[model samples]
Target: MKLIIKSLIMILFAAGAYAADEPDMKAGEDIAMKGTPEGATACFACHGTRTEENKTGSFPRMVNQSQYYILQQLKDYSSGARNNAVMGPIAKALTDKEKADVAAYYAKILFPTPKVKKAASAVLKRGEELAVVGDLKIQVQACNNCHGPGGMGMAPAIPAIAGQHANYLEAQLKAWKDGQRKNSADLMGPIAKRLSDKDISALALYFEQVQINAGKAVAK
Candidate 1:
């Protein structure tokens, strides 16, 4: 009985310490709703809330992202590897724990997809071809090759693009092509460079129409 009690005590103490080290989710929620005093903008202003989809396609949906992926992006923004006029300042302002907390907050929530305008069937067909089967002429692999089937995202590194905002997707592709975004330079850089403006538009619209369930990237 004495040995069992001692073991239980040790286990409880370890669990308490582990929980203490974990990010404070309530603090994260506060940061999201209200920007940090460090000069970061309120994430809700751009990323939206759990109940609301992003107001426009200009912003990428933040929910459903993995914590590691979110953290890396924040780090990249701060380091200028992924330069953005808006995100650069925001990322720089966040302390390390704040970054972790916010990442944790977004990673766990699954937001609903907003209704989006449909693209022309022809355009969607072309986009589907690009996403499902890459164009041999350009030697570009299917977007799904890395993003996972249905753009559900492979997690840890890749982001789910299915049901993402078309405008945001277009913007990112353009950024990659223009060499303005260097985070995934070796991979997305080459692919985006090969895509024409029309192709980019089609791909973006197609992905925006894909059905994604939950934050885990399940296909509907």
Candidate 2:
């Protein structure tokens, strides 16, 4: 009984700490629009200001990403755990609060209906097979198992990959394959290693073309 009481107190304290660390969405929006005082760049120039655009998923749609996933990626870039020629320097320039704020700002934005472009039938079929069900012969797990259905992301951690840039997705997968990106070792690493170049391209293309349900974004 006494032990249980102590555990409850510890849990409450941890929860309180998390709440205090939550970023201010308004402050984040300011940073996204304008450069930070510490020489950080404006995110909009690369990421774009709107939810959806006329172009293909090139720079990526940031609005529906999970705040925690975005923050973790920024921290990874800052610490050189994840290396990007552009993002590495940009992330390094940001203060921790600035990172949190920017992530929060993006998370609060609305998810727009994507203007998806069709991919080849063969590629789409292969992608669907790999995503919805695992390629068991290579020991790969279904992406949806972690990313949720249609790669809409399992919130509070995973970022939505649906309707993301095919090039960007392929690059990241290659990074994991080559040991450049080292964020999700236990999960993403093995899976990435198992993927062939063709598999990678197919998966990226599939996600690039699938639209997410705006508010719910649940697995189908």
Candidate 3:
């Protein structure tokens, strides 16, 4: 009898897991179609359904982004760990299931073609050098170790930092360095704590100027 009960429980758990994995594209489409004022933008307007215009230097293409990473980011934004006025309200309004559905929809989409041709400036170049190779005296690890050589980041965990707004990057780093941002991993927390104001600014500027080669890179 105990064995039969255990089997039933296992079956139920499997079913639940299967349900969780199912992608609800229709729901995602509906959300995209119905742009929320509080959310303040339709994802399709920026990301597009299927096109190369989505691949710009200013906007990190959301197409093909990892679902787990997207979900985590949404949660972070909603909770204020990752703060963006534009994204914060939008994230706050989404249910967990909505977040998951949106993430899935974007993750399944193919990457758009990139068109950005400009390179980083001298100051930005300096910032990039610092990010890729930190000063040992400062006890800073190269951002590349986790964010990848080009700032693409690891899937389902770390997020892509490439092409993010310099202001936004600066703010986030400052938050991390201080105790204001609390939702980061233990490793990141310590790293953030160690960063000086100057270090944070340099890293943010560096990532902002970096262009991601979508075909070769994965954003966090």
Candidate 4:
């Protein structure tokens, strides 16, 4: 009889814990739309609404991301684990609750469709050769093995690289190659280590020009 009572109590406690962790989606939207308590700009201003133009690529699209992933990134920015000068200040200013709220809000937004101009014949030919066949002399794997044929990422872990800003992609690839960024997966470390500077530059340029359909579920 005592064991049965204890089991019931434990179950109730677990239920309460789950409820506490679940984000309130509506409240998150409100906070995201209204701005952080310190009067920072609303996220939509940079990410764009359903019809707005997000031309500068100053902000990466945040829509349709996993809430857990978004929360982790915000915390990383806030704690100085991820170091982007512009984002660090903004992230540091947010309260914990506000961080969760904004994460949920962005995760619920629709992902933006990408539009890319066709590459020049020479560039496209080079990119296709490298992405599909790899250069045997360099010992590089075909990019499509991990990044997918269209550059859609494998999901919650790998980010979609298609249509990311060319400059941003180049910078990140350099960081990874030089060991300046250490947060990547074990597989990524070795793969990045094998890439030459020129190879990295070409791959980044190629991916920046690739496009993917928005609103489709990414691999997770």
> lDDT: which candidate is best?
1
> What does the lDDT come to for candidate 2?
0.76
lDDT string for model 3 (113-216, tens) is 44433334665665666677866776767777766667766555556776555556777667677767766534465676777776677677667656556445
Task: Estimate every model's Cα lDDT from 0 to 1.
Answer: 0.82, 0.76, 0.64, 0.62
Query: How big is the RMSD of model 4?
Result: 9.8
- How much is the lDDT of residue 75 in candidate 2? 86
In model 2, which runs have C-alpha deviations exceeding 4 angstroms? 1-22, 51-58, 216-220
Score residue 206 of candidate 1 by CA lDDT.
92
Model 2, backbone clash pairs (residues 3+ apart or across chains), number: 0
Worst 10 residues of 2 by lDDT: 1-10
lDDT of 2 at 11: 38
**Residues 4-122, candidate 2, lDDT per residue (tens digit)?**
33543553454345542868888888888897888778888778775634354456678568777788788888998877787888898888998999988888776556555678899
Local error of candidate 1 at residue 119 (angstroms) = 0.9
Using all chains and alpha carbons, the TM-scores for the candidates as numbered come to 0.86, 0.84, 0.66, 0.70
Model 4 per-residue lDDT tens digits across residues 93-160 = 87877777777777666655566555566665666567667777766667775555656654443456
Write the number of the candidate with greater lDDT, choosing between 1 and 3: 1
Backbone collision tally, model 4: 2
